[model samples]
Target: MKEPSPRRLPTGVAAAAGVLLIIPVLALLIVPLYAKKGPQLWGFPFFYWYQFLWVFLASGFTYSAYVLIERARRGERR
Candidate 1:
């Protein structure tokens, strides 16, 4: 008997997932974009709050990508 082949996500879905994952990484890497002290939120400096916000944003992006990839895989399997 032959073994079942692994399911692969569609090219577009895989590219979209890759882009989603890269967004947070690229955002954090560009330090000058958030290295400021004004526009405080709840007494937190812009620098502090900006990075903190990305934590949630990154989680959301990651989750979205995961769901997209999973959906594509499921579709391919069927």
Candidate 2:
């Protein structure tokens, strides 16, 4: 029988990935930050459009973080 080995992250890479992953969570978590009505984008209120936009931003950030962490993990194994 064999046990799976442990994995480690490079210095600062984990924190960077964590920060990237948290961006969307923090953005939506803060209500007052985007809870507003003003400046419209193609008839869309700032509040409405801002949150909608974060959808893409969140995905991008998530994917980026995933790539970063995965890359570091691959490097750690070598």
Candidate 3:
């Protein structure tokens, strides 16, 4: 397989860059939402469990994005 070519122009580079730029922002969006105090969830309190659940939820999203990106890259190779 051939190495993917780099974008020649700033516009193309910027467009490619733009997609990745939103990822950090998306990852951070859940942080504040979990920072509230509230009642317990199951045995743990909302503050504790909410952050704990975010770990699994964020893992799911990260895995999904990786799989999708892999699929698209493989498709391009064929």
User: Model 2 compared with the native: what TM-score?
Assistant: 0.86
Q: What is the lDDT of candidate 3?
A: 0.61
The ten-residue window of minimal lDDT in model 1 covers 2-11
Clashes of each: 0, 0, 0
Give the poorly placed runs of model 1, Cα more than 4 Å off: none
lDDT of 1 by residue, 19-59 (tens): 99999999999999999998999999999999999999999
**Could you tell me how far off, in angstroms, the CA of residue 52 lies in candidate 3 after the best superposition?**
0.4
lDDT of 2 by residue, 1-78 (tens): 757877777769989999999999999999899888888899999899999999999999999999999998888777
| TM-score for each model | 0.92, 0.86, 0.58
- Clashing pairs for predicted structure model 1, backbone only: none
Which candidate number has the best lDDT?
Answer: 1
**Better candidate number, 1 or 3, judged by TM-score:** 1
lDDT of each: 0.94, 0.91, 0.61
Ranking by lDDT: 1, 2, 3
Off by over 4 Å in 2: 1-3
On TM-score, the candidate that comes out on top is 1
Worst ten-residue run, lDDT, model 2? 2-11
Extract clashing residue pairs from model 3: none
